[model samples]
Target: NAGVTQTPKFRILKIGQSMTLQCAQDMNHNYMYWYRQDPGMGLKLIYYSVGAGITDKGEVPNGYNVSRSTTEDFPLRLELAAPSQTSVYFCASSSGLSNEQFFGPGTRLTVL
Candidate 1:
């Protein structure tokens, strides 16, 4: 893809279930990030990677995990899903913090 791409546009999970949200970018960006947006709220960062094999927790990283094994892929793992995890997740990539980030369509997740 030319920009950021995320799979599974929508999903529903039972409590305690787990799923992976896949994200990729073909632009060879050095910075990638995951964010979650709750109803009536702005996007909150979950995790971010400055480059492959380097990652750090953001404002909200609980119950979520991320790995950056390659420049193009940064996948977020949700383990033991809970109702509190329900939100719209987005992936973004950018050449640098000063540059604009390109976002994916987003994955809407619901947990009961």
Candidate 2:
């Protein structure tokens, strides 16, 4: 089965610019999430959605936003980006809160 897919494996964004990271899965899962991993640091949650029309902020939701309008798509938005936001972003999904998540390779974002 096709798991998760992310675009522009690498990206460079100027400070104060904006971009959207796309994430899609064909696993028919119900839980989707966005997270950022920095050098020498663990992943930090940005946002998650339980289902269409339902969304919630995670640990480090600042500077980012998300929306879930369908079962297979969950996109993350970065507005007025800053250097601190520079990190590798990963998109993951699980069957439920207690299920093990499957992750995409990742998108490396560099904000200069």
Candidate 3:
């Protein structure tokens, strides 16, 4: 089974383009999160979901959104992409609140 998966490993977008970074896992995790990593910086949480129909914004939620409609899928939506939003996005999942998170490979996004 795929632990976690992300689509379009690499993408380049115009300044105003919009896209959705898809994330899915077959582990049936209860906690899911979206994070972005800038060069030489630690990961920053953008959004998260504890279960289906429950979503919350994290430290940096501007220009991004997320929805959790199922236990195995959580997608991050970037509306009106910008150069500041260019970063490597990661999707992670954990079975419980205190468990270690399993992260997806990552989606590299470039906005020019």
Please give the RMSD to the true structure for each candidate, in Å.
0.7, 0.7, 0.5
lDDT string for model 3 (4-107, tens) is 99997999999989999999999999999999999999999999999999999999999998999999899999999999998999999999998999999999
Q: What overall lDDT, based on C-alpha atoms, would model 1 receive against the true structure?
A: 0.97
Q: What's the lDDT for candidate 2? A: 0.93
The order of the candidates by TM-score, greatest first, is 3, 1, 2
| Model 3 residue 56 lDDT score | 98
Candidate 2 per-residue C-alpha lDDT over 1-111 given as tens digits, one digit per residue, 9 for 90 to 100: 889988879999999999999999999889999999999999999999998889999999999999999999999999998999999999999999999999988999999
Per-candidate TM equals 0.98, 0.97, 0.98
lDDT of 1 by residue, 54-92 (tens): 999999999999999999999999999999999999999
The 10 consecutive residues of candidate 2 with the worst lDDT sum are: 1-10
Against the reference, the lDDT scores of all candidates come to 0.97, 0.93, 0.95
Kindly report which residue stretches of model 2 are placed more than 4 angstroms away from their true locations once superposed: none
Name the runs in model 1 displaced over 4 angstroms.
Answer: none
Best-fitting candidate, measured by lDDT?
Answer: 1
**Which runs in model 3 stand beyond 4 Å of their true positions?**
none
Each candidate's clash count:
0, 0, 0
